[model samples]
Target chain A: MKTVYVCSNTVTGIYSAIYDAWKARKGEEECSVALRGAVETELFCEYVEVEETVHKAQAVEALICRHLGREAYWDIYHAVLAADTGKGDAILGAMLAAKTIPDSRRIMEHLSHPKVEKVFELSRSVIGEAHFLKGAVRFRELAGGVLYARISPKAQVLTCLAPHFADRLPLENWMIYDRVHRMFVIHEAKKRWILVQDEFLDPERLPDLTEEEKEYTKLWKGFVHAVSVESRENLKLQRQHLPLRFRPDMVEYM
Target chain B: MSSSESMTTYTYEGIPQYMPQGAGGLRPSMFQKLNILADAAKYDVACTSSGTARSNDGTGMGSCERSGICHSYSADGRCISLLKILFTNECIYDCKYCINRRSNDVIRTSFTPDEVCTLTIEFYRRNYIEGLFLSSGILRSPDYTMELIYAAIYKLRKEYNFQGYIHVKAIPGASKELIQKVGFLADRMSVNLELPTAESLKLLAPHKTRKNILTPMRLVQNRMAENKQELALYRNAPGFVPAGQSTQMIIGATPETDFQIMQVAQSLYQRFELKRVFYSAFIHVNEDSLLPARTDEGPPLLREHRLYQADWLLRYYHFRAEELLSEENPNFNVLFDPKCNWALKHLGQFPVEINRADYKMLLRVPGLGYKSAVRIVKARRVGTLDFSDLKKIGVVLKRAMYFITCNGKMLYPTKLEEDYIARNLLSAGEKLPGEVVNMGYHQLSLFDDVGFSGKMQQYM
Candidate 1:
């Protein structure tokens, strides 16, 4: 029998834990698997704790992103996080299994595997949002070398969102904080990355809100409003394209 | 004031792609300039990252995932996810078809390196685009024009530390050194073939030559190869063009057939490792007498779409140019997509037992998109995927049903006849605007006053 550790939060967090689990597996210690964000009773094996480390997290990220391939990395990340089980060991085992198989997208082992379904569904939603938000989301520079913004997604999609930002803004001094999850991704490519999770997010805490932000905010809002023509006041079409839910956060919608 | 900047749609009424000034020549706000440029640029369907190798090196600033990003969509019904704009609309080369040609009498403008860097960072921050897609008409000299473009890209990537996707166009006559410099900074670089054939280029665009155009393209391809080789040898070779290089060919411009265009595209990919080959449909702009007159009916937009489909097939589906078209047939079928049409010709290959068909065979099936082809591989391993299961997963059976079989059973009862199926599929889409216009759209327009249609056809 083996003890399984579960990590059921973000892709980075799970990846960080994967680094730990892989190391343990290589050792003489017994290893087992479970999904994150899960709670249950331990039968026999002693539970061991692994703290998140940047070095371990970096290795997992590099392995998935560099060695594994782009699409697979996305699929595994989504699948790993979407599974409701907090048995981190199980998820990690499944992820490791996925890596070995050339064709990783085998839906799920079981039909009702929440993580597998979540991975598929969330990836789709995140991709769609990323495409649209590539236009809708606005970013501004905050002090402390952080680029800050908020994304309101329909499907729980903070995990899938970071890679796009990470890929595009890797070298840039930036941070994308998911307010819904109270998590933030800090990326300074080739420099240092700090991912803050399960912590308080104070919007005002981000530095560097100068006059430029104020002016651009007003300007962006005006541009969006100006583009909406009264001649074609098709609220249905407008709402179809830009939903009421997203408008609260977006300046153009406002 | 530029017509594009003033009015809504580009009806080609006044100078298109120009920033409209209000009243007595007032400067438009930066936001308004972007709207105009974004709207103007939405039509250029060139910013793509597919059919290329992935970024394996850890040394590059960033990489372009196989799935492309559309920073934003402009009014012209294309992605504006990139900062698509001209370095300067002030062109000395009087390409008759260009909106920004010297003789067009339009308001000219240029953006400095600093200005471009600021806009890209700003738009990128707001999540407006992935990066910059910068192109320019020949300004001053080719080298000089190229220098400004390189300066801006380098400034954005180097100075601002911007790792966003930058797709820059290399001026035909630009120096090899300059092209290499930008190649290092840009994720993707392209030199527009502009016209399909050398003949059309000579006739319509007398200033540009085949040698001038292909030289820079060849140079970039060589440098990219060298970079990859170096990576293998040293594992620390500096990145050249991480996204690789892609080129554009203006469709419907010349008398070149889809076969000829595909051959060029195939050679570019084989010779240069091209990421993509964009096919921009020609829309007439001038009254260049040397050009064949295209009637008001316009260049074949459907043909252009089909060419793109054919291009995709050539690049990914492992379909060869000879397999797709011949010198006799030349053009793609106006109705069915190239993949479906190709499969219909080779019916013997299908019904190969989905359980056993290889990746290449599965890719050949109609309705199996890039993803579906990939999906079929995984699903079959769990168990032999039946026709019903394929549909449940994602395959569009409407088209594939005609081509494929489930466990040696054809879906339909009737005998398979390629001709019969093709005709039905021919009348499938809208009547293709006008079918019986036997002559090419250009031939009929010559007698009628040489209108905009004639000029754009040269580049098409």
Candidate 2:
């Protein structure tokens, strides 16, 4: 009979499930991980509820960093943040497969392994979305002088975008809200950034924009319209690159 | 026409404006100036913000990404990476193709250094642009125009502490000292080639000579080489054009073959050490007899697209221009891309075994991008990759199926003949350009030699 460790759909929850499954000392075929809501009950299978904790997640993170190396650990970390429910099981399977190999750190390069490939694909997708959101994230100046941006990314990408903007706008107070994930990445001027999760902020309730902000928005829209060549207009190609999903928040589109 | 009188009347939003028009001229507001300058600069076509990655240094309010970022895409589908604009539209040269020629009666205005700085910083703060792309028309002289541009960027860098990407144009015939000073402040610098050949330039732009343009390009190239050594010696040495330099040529303006244009691009990459060579399809903005006759056919966007595809091959795919086009075949095939056309022409190299082929060989496969080719090589080392695995690796197997064999087996029962494969690839839903598709397949047979027999044929 196979044993499935069930946990919530989060980095901490997934890592804690991996921790419990690892401590079971069962063979790779005997144990698996699944998200709490996404798990389908299998016949003659032992389902264990993982007691998720910060310490367990930290221990597993350190274990992977020490054994599988930082590069593989990074892929696993991003895979856990992916939207796919299979990501937790895939990551756990990849980790188990790594132990069988002579060199565990090179597990990501074993792309032919189905579990490892799943993790690689998931990590690539999460990073790809994060990279796109880095540029697509737009900041509007509020009446209070803080720069606020809202992005409804597919993955929980607030963590990835915060450091990039924090480095780019070190002197300016800025905050980015992930509407889909209901999280916030807040950074004060001349200070480090912090990620706040489970924040319920209504999308329609953003503060009023500054007078300068409105003027600049109008100017930016005009500039976008002016810069395009009238003869070479191709809405299909523009949609291909910019995509329709990111248009709602963009000032030029608005 | 005095500068003092124009300045007082052009005030807006408490910021003093600089107007270059004579008395009785309407003082265009900031909105109008941005519209005019941005519209004028749109034709230059080098808006990339890549090549340098610098953090904000904890003092400034900007940083650069090595891969660059697109803040927005215009309706024309061009990436809005930089706030591309002209410092002024006032010109002394009557270039035949230019909209802002000296003979033309256009609104002539200049952005003061402060105005340029404020726009860049404010726009950058809103994440509307990656940085600034400052080009200008000749105001009195090349040196004078270059000095005005230098003043704006110098303030943006030193006083405003803007650490963002800045791409500036090195004005042709500007003093070498002034050009050198501007190079230190810009991340990337370019001198427009204007036209592919000297004869076309002479006919189109009477004031710009090949020597005048290449001189400043050579100056930046030499300075960048020296800056590399200085940075090697002193870690914190101020760099000159750290993102390197690029140049652009106006295609279809003159009677230059695609082969001739590509040869010029190849030499620029090899000899001049240019980072990029942009090809702008000549749009008829001015009515000049010397220019190509205005037709219902818009800009030669398809041709420009092909050149860009070939340009990517030159830079990334380890391909030479000669491999892509020749005097016998001066233009790219309308039906297939450069790589697919090359593969079809040389079918003897077909059916490369995925399990045994090397990275370079995989890159030549019809539908294998560099990324997927790399992934195939890595993944195959761990396990054999079949057709399904290739699809999983992001290879467009619909096209690659005709060219590749996985584990000594083709994806489908297909002939190795070029005509058979080309027809199959066409039916595989390869999205042809709208112009080609709209022309209808029956008409395509008559137009098979589209580039070889059209207006471009006269040049050949």
* B-chain TM-score of model 1: 0.80
Off by over 4 Å in 2: A202-206, B1-26, B355-358, B379-389, B406-414, B441-460
Provide C-alpha RMSD values for all models, in order.
9.7, 3.8
Please give the lDDT score at residue A243 for candidate 2.
83
Scored on chain A only, each candidate's TM-score is 0.58, 0.96
Worst-scoring 10-residue span by lDDT in model 2 chain A: A198-207
State the C-alpha lDDT per candidate.
Answer: 0.63, 0.87
Model 1, residue B95: C-alpha shift (Å): 1.2
What lDDT does model 1 reach? 0.63
* lDDT (10s digit) by residue, model 2, range B263-359: 8999999999999999999889889888877877788888888889988888888888898888888888776788998899888988999999988
lDDT of 1 by residue, A135-190 (tens): 45556756454567776654345545565566555556666666666777667765
* Chain A TM-score, structure 2: 0.96
TM-score of chain B of each: 0.80, 0.92
